[model samples]
Target chain A: MSQPGQGLSVGLFATCINDVMFPDTPKHVAELLTRLGCSLTSSPAQTCCGQMFTNTGYFREGEATVEAYVEAFADCDYVVAPSASCIGSVRHQHQMLAAHRPALARKVDRLIKRSLDLTEFLTDILEVEDVGASFPHTVTYHTGCHSLRVARIGDRPQRLLRAVRGLRLVDLADSDICCGFGGTFCLKNPDVSIAMATNKAKAVADTKAEYLAAVDNACLMNIGGILHRIKAPVTPIHVASILVQQEP
Target chain B: MSQLTTLPRDTDGRLTPAPPPGELIDMPRFPINARHELANTDQRNNLQAATATIRAKRALRVSEVPQWEDLRQAAKTIKDQVDRHLDSYLLQAEQSLTKAGAIVHWARDATEANQIVVDLVKATGAPEVVKVKSMVTQETELNEALEQAGIAAWETDLAELIVQLGHDRPSHVLVPAIHKNRSQIKDIFLTEMGQYGTPAPADLTDDPSALTSAARTHLRNKFMRSTVGISGGNFLVADTGTLVVVESEGNGRMCLTLPQTLISVVGIEKIVPRFEDLEVFMRLLPRSSTGERMNPYTSMWTGVTPGDGPQNVHVVLVDNGRTSVLADPIGRQTLRCIRCSACMNTCPVYTLVGGHAYGSVYPGPIGICLSPLMRGLDSPIDQSLPYACTLCGACPDVCPVKIDFPEVIIHLRHEVAEHKIRDTKPHLETTAIAAAGWFFAKGRRFTVMTWLSGLVGRVFKAKKQFGAHMPWPARLWTSARDLPIPAAESFREWWRRNHERP
Candidate 1:
């Protein structure tokens, strides 16, 4: 739990979901870190964290992905990922998933100590708020359940958002509840999943904010999909995109 | 009676019950039941309002106590001690109860327990028996057994009376009729109370007070006339042979005291090692259950006195499925539940779907763990109960004994997966997961797979996003919510294109 010195070295651990679907999120995260004066390195050996398999009760299958993740980031000072859910798995679940492999488990423990969710890297490691970016829009932030409860990243994302030049942050009702994008849960139980997502969508719409942003794109995907289906005016944006966007 | 004539006796000359028809797992699967329960708008509204109110009240009351965490830890430690040495505690409890003049009966399962109760009622020659709110009796379906034996069992608690009269199953553990609003209760009382004993007044209204008054009047006659009573114990003190019942309504007090012959059917997990152990539970139960500093009625009794309440007392210690639950190293923590229902109040799923969807006498998070263990997870419904939760962790946060609900749920999911693996044919989910695991094990394979999937996604893109309807296995994701179209270039591809130079 040691603090990183100024100008700390960081590895951009763009998760599989972000790598395949939302490439702009990682791009924005890289720009945000560069703006905050941290050196960024990209590892070509990185892939999925096996959160999907681990969460769906496939521990053995998930262990392989944990081994890949530990190997990918073994030498980095800080491994920063845009998704709290993936970082949560790396920080909390990697040891449990890798327990059968003692040597790999030790590697996982060391990797998790250096792993940080993007917000944690910004707030805790860099000690930087007010990233000197401007975005003129009223936005509501959805705190992913893993980030809020597991990582205990309370108000760090909001504090960073408030410091943006023209970004207005509105409160979301029941902000702490899960938005129902629980890895494979959305597929396993679609009926309940949509029911929960619809409630979250309505809460977001009620805020009348032009944009809904969150640390984890997986939740945003679920909420954003429903918003698009209902033809809501609000768009889903990654918090990193807002932090790095500069007015032309 | 005609029904009793059909009863068979065992070879040892005891009543060999007919397999205790309609035992646990009679209800439909959890998902099917939840689908139906979710469609009922009235039930959803009632549950939402009730759970929200109770949750807020509980939070306020629990926060007032500075040592709440210490109390919860103490409660957990004591329960673990009791569970660890449960064999010795049971023997000590039996010895102490026998010394106090209370007859103790040991029942292996539902049939034996029902037979013991029926024989006890027949010995007293009472045509009817009054009941305090007892979860063990509900778990064993004792009331139906008694009815078949020509004995009418009257439910005295207001909520249980509603469920009994309405011919409905109990939903929530603490509040059996939590799904019913005041007007529904009024209608149930008006139509059903008369057949049971006394009729509801002609001018009865839907007001809660008026409804409770009507229940009180109807139950008074049954309480005065019945010569036998049955109950479930909250906590059984091993050293003192004392049985405690914590309740809100005065009906429990009446049922516990008025009958001449009293029978208590309690789960073996309800025992604590010492009398002082009651202090932690007494404080935890009321606050976690009714959100009250102290419930209106907490009646504790030890055996019988010559001229005092219930001269002939019997204690039936039932281990219907508790021993099996205790055997699981990871799941044994579920037995620590005191049936407070705090987890139910805070659960978003329970608030939305109500308790009947769980298909067990115990509902909510505890039910999800307890029912499967008790029933052996052989049925589809038993397997489905563990997945009913979203793994929100709200239940574990508020649980008095701090049951790690999400951990147990994941463990059960693993059990289900392992069970499926044992079958000749592998499940589609298992196959898909294994395939994904293979790809994820190596970074190069994953990168190649993502590149190909993104290429296909780009070709199939209609109107710049995937349509609402998708093909077969992926349809599970698309049937409800639209999937975001994959990026034309993955982050890895973009990184390779921009940064990598030959």
Candidate 2:
């Protein structure tokens, strides 16, 4: 049987955070999807999803960015992103931005249906659990709030990690709680954000896993900062980077 | 120069002074209050243990019922119906209550509600009252209002008793003293209980049974002696003109029955059109709240009994900012809340900083929506309240009535932004967001910004030295945690060299 991704063109929505801060995550996402037999496409025209603006309550500005996103991937077969949060905003908030106009709402609805978070596309549309990759390390997954609750992506990332040739997936304590990146919330309420991140980092350290893998790089960045700050033995790694590993 | 000279007491020997008048809101901005809360390590430890245990209990109980989701849907539907036809239902309720030989009063705001209750208690010629745990009363500052009129209101519920005795604000809806551990409660009781009413044993320990025994002894006298009882209803059954008060303790039953004159101050939004609608809430509230199959005491009375219970029954339908919440299309669903702290127990933010951080009686996710909607976004705290959550989407998932917390929170945020924009001067946060939105509107501008960051990255790498803190805003991030240096190679730069747009 042919792979589910064999004849599809996938638009890689390298979210702004990944584009500027952690390029490896989206680059790896592109790499993984291409190797899985999907044709990767992109528009350098794409930037932020305006989640920061939308989440911060600046709806008019967020709508401006939302229009740009629509124009960027308007022709793609499917819009997939390494960041679950931006995908969540696209699916959840884009309609509200377009709600004043019925024609635009219908167009945005079409885009929402075609969009998928990385783990979702892998298990849902592509139907492949094991991607024949190997990563010989004990890793735990931090379920990003957007990944777990917003997108409701469930255990697809964990399933993908479990299927890896040499990966041992450990359980994270209170893994469902937010890592506290929260877009602008990290800065707006740094005290609470750092407190939560510290707790999450401590939990990650207690697992004794070599790596903490999460779907969102923003979460990894926040937790990674705390992990690095506290000098914890564990490293924060994205699921894309781990899955893209060809050698243990 | 005696401490006793400073303290005032009512004729019945209950504490006469009322607590702060503000309800359902904290005073300062969220960051400031959250920092204060986060510093108290003991409170943090207590919160973590308490919320975790409650979350586990709720999850286990919720798992037992396969129809839990169905129950949530039914509850949501029933609440939605009440919100849509609230005026008609309120009228129907008044008719039913009057037919059942109960007096009905309407309160347009918290002050009006407080005045009605005070006047009603004064009419009974009562010096004090035993109160069933009521959040609406807290919202109206009713106890304080009563105290202002020289009438003492004695809290009958265990947690409420703890709060009242200690002169502490309620931190959680279900468990008012949720921020306090057993040891803390022991200290509060040892120090404050004797001053208020009955005294604790000299050798009172932090053991649960010991504490309960002490509280029972302290409150039993007040419960029996008080001629008036005050309560806030959980559900106001419109068709039968019934009011419900659910609690784990039997104090609600005692207070609802022992007093001759009973007064219930209910939010207009608490109405459920039919008596049978309670079957849905009875199932959802207990499991979601105390994590029990059913509460130990569920005191529900339709108007009154001829001679049994309190023959003089009064219901004050208070609309303190509730109409404001009802008017919003996006946020009206928040009124569906059943005051079950399921959202609180499961909320990660609430778990960390506890309810005190929210600075409101109704904390966690529900307050984030309801407080802003009811109070408006004009206040600094209310503006900051919407951003308090990490938007983790946990609260909505666990809400018994399926209130979409994140959606409402985001909507409130938009209102806050709009409110800020209406000010004469521009705001830094909104300006920054607008500028970022401008850059993101075009990939070229985004690329240029990334290139600037990459240039800074090169300079830092070349210098082999940079300050630990980047600058003003980034320093906020670096204060507690290390942040990544911007990548020298922008993704666009790498992608351009490697392949075409494809």
Candidate 3:
């Protein structure tokens, strides 16, 4: 597929967790966008879209956060997020939040219409087949719950990864299953949450992948934590991070 | 009643413990070998193929009905209303059933419920009982109880018979032997069926028909001989005092009709306010559960027919923690389940490992929510269930009632935590949470912590462990996952260092 060079200007919304917990994710996303020949800009005003609070039942804080996110991503060609959960919040909840706040609702709807998961934006919108990067390591992909079920993104991540020059993609068993990291769920129900992650870890290990890649970093963190604990060699890398890799 | 002669109620009554409140919480420790079994490629392949086949069939039958969604909404509404007024509905159901000449028994727990049924059976002097597939009976371990009293409980359903003979736990709710493939089933039939079953073909292959026919022949004698039938109701209509049982196979139909005496142990939550309510559930159930537009057998009986089938019908209204589940406002919706395995089948996790990994008879999205409510969140397995999901919305998407399973799971996770705090000492968890709270309380504090993390990330970067650092309980995650080591500077730090005005 030919990469669309025009109409490809993209804006990236690095989730707060990724910003604080793993800043490299957004950095890689920006790098990938640059390589795709899209004029990319990171909106600094975007601290959070209030997903964490809203999911935890703090609607009021979520509303305020949604307003902040809309203001920041207002004029973007397309607002892209690395985390499906964050994008889902903006698409589903922001619309709900906009119901009572009409002014904000109209603004969010405009942005959300053009908003997309990075994989969806890259492969579907930009039509970028391969980013021309090579990492010969065997890797498995996990479809984060939000990306696959919530965002309805299928085969996009794989399509993009398959185009990469040297990546050998081995399918993870139950790749669609959650990594048991529901944000706060990891901290709140640590043991049970870990138990679920262990299963994901085992699945990734079974694939014998050097890297476990997914769209969402929240799931990656939880699975990564479990892998670290068990000392498994599998590395949990965000899809954007992998896509932006250079020939080092 | 010719069927009455075969039931030996006295002996069955003596052996088993009755259904008890929190029976699941105190369940004997199940072996923790689910990981190894789940890794079995053969079982995984079999389960994937089987669940997918049933799901496709269910989807086909259900789509034929244009009003399926409307029926589902109606069912959800009725259930919501019943749950809101459960106490009054239970009393009304009891009064109506009793007035209609059907004896009503109230069971406080599993033991009491089991004893009540056993007492009624003992009163009838039946030595053996033909059983219908009832999740409640399975939940209460009723067959095991009956066996202790030397009253043989014969499983008549195709899947239940396999489970009983195999001496295995029911993995999936609807398809109890879902984890067992045809080869394993053929072997079970071959070995267990001695003279009781038709002689096995010496070289029976893994064809479904061969296995099914072997099972049919094995169960045929039990069906012909047993007089008393013990069953569970899918729905009990309060307005008409009718009990409904929907199944794919014709076994439930035979059990309901051929018996002289019938005892149904039903959860009080199963009550629907009016007979018309059955209209919604009948359509919602078969489609959402078995994915059938309509289940093959849907048997409804009101009280007793003096000369039709069972001369006597007794309905045991079982509480068994249901009242407690109802008492919990958020958790009550779990009782709205119609025992449809749709959610289980569509569930990615449940589909991957099958139901046995949940360590409860009720597995998948519903089980994760229901088990904790019925059993409490004390056991490791029970506590682990809610976290089993990746919070995928697949189960809720296919739910006939739109139970919002993901919402319920997050809620249950909260309950598990609260239970841990109030009931058990959460020393490590509490300490960790407190420590995390202290660190992230303010912007400056968070910034400092992030700064320290960035430094550590650099150390790991030098070692190429980027995206792979974890430090004990947290480290448990890394054994299977790689943590990213942070770059030397964060965006804010980088901005501060590079873009600082000189």
Per lDDT, the best of the predicted structures is 2
- Model 1 lDDT at residue B69: 99
Ranking by TM-score: 2, 1, 3
Better of 1 and 3 by DockQ: 1
Q: Give the clashing pairs for model 2.
A: B26-B359
Candidate 1 TM-score to native: 0.94
Model 1 over residues B425-498: C-alpha lDDT tens digits? 76898888888888888889888887887897688666566656778776766776777878878888887887
Candidate 3 wrong stretches, greater than 4 Å: A1-13, A20-24, A28-81, A87-143, A148-214, A218-248, B1-33, B39-42, B59-67, B194-207, B423-426, B466-475, B498-502
Q: CA shift at A166, candidate 3, in angstroms?
A: 16
- What DockQ does each prediction reach against the true complex? 0.63, 0.79, 0.21
lDDT of candidate 3 over B381-470, digit per residue (tens): 787677666566878778887788877776676666566556655556545544554443333444576678788776766764533345
Task: Point out the higher-scoring one by TM-score: 2 or 3.
Answer: 2
Fraction of reference contacts reproduced per prediction?
0.52, 0.80, 0.24
By TM-score, the best candidate is 2
lDDT of 3: 0.74
Q: Candidate 1 or 3, higher TM-score? A: 1
Per-model TM-score versus the true fold: 0.94, 0.96, 0.76
Report the lDDT tens digits of candidate 2 across residue range B202-243. Answer: 999999999999999988878877778998899989999988
Sort by DockQ, top down from the best: 2, 1, 3
User: Alpha-carbon error at B332 in model 2, in Å?
Assistant: 0.8
Q: For residues A45-122, could you state the per-residue lDDT of candidate 3 as single tens digits?
A: 566656554554334456666766776678788888887778877886777656797888889878888878888887
